[model samples]
Target: GTLLTSLTEELPINLKQLDNVEKTKTALTPVFTQFQQVLEQVIAEGKFTALPLTITVEGIENYLEYRKIDFALGKQTFFSDWLPKAFIQNTAQFETVTNLSSSEVAQRIENLGSGEIKLLSVRVDSRNIVMRYSR
Candidate 1:
């Protein structure tokens, strides 16, 4: 949270780069290429289809990077509108949002209490998820 707040304020932050990125790239390149090929084929079919692929990465959460991937399904789907609209509606419920003051947020961070705790300000606009903390 502190790192996020610092970023909002344009303050310098200390971050450690993940080592051996080249190694990871070299290992995953072939798999990624194959995956791309599969997606291209599926897209070319132009059918109401769902493709499932599972990916796992190590030590990414601790890397202090914020990443969001959003794609519109309407452009790719054979049917018009309904699937994409439903998809957008379903995901809006999962955004972590909070209205607490920054001091209360700081206390939550300080305590690091057990079990599930979410303190954030999230906005979902046009099906795109934007997350901000103390900005």
Candidate 2:
């Protein structure tokens, strides 16, 4: 079944938006990890169907100006500005994305850490991206 969904979550990453404010890896997780770690706040929105899940991050304490993700269908029109060049070069699956089983992700996460997850819970429903963490 084909579902249609369009939602705008433009609220800042403040206490009001995130009820249980804690260590969250928003859509900007990779951006934060690969680029700037000083940003404590940002904004995020995904078109649900867009293959690459467009993520936009604006001024967080005026660190950087406008940045946008251009993805239409099953391909990213352009690599994220801050996306490490090594990432693009080292990307094993460039032509397509491989879906990893939950157990696979869990096992890999466990291997990377001492049985802890970055995003404890991640799911999509009613055209929304929901997440939770172990607090």
Candidate 1 has which clashing residue pairs, if any? none
Which regions of candidate 1 are displaced past 4 Å?
A: 1-18, 48-135
Task: For residues 16-118, write the lDDT of model 2, one tens digit per residue.
Answer: 5465545344744555554332222111222222232212111112211111111221233222111311112211111211233334433332343322222
What clash pairs does model 2 have?
none
Q: TM-scores of all models?
A: 0.23, 0.18
Q: Rate the local accuracy (lDDT) of all candidates.
A: 0.29, 0.27
Candidate 2 residue runs with Cα over 4 Å from true position: 1-50, 54-117, 125-128
The superposed Cα distance between candidate 1 and the true structure at residue 66, in angstroms, equals 54
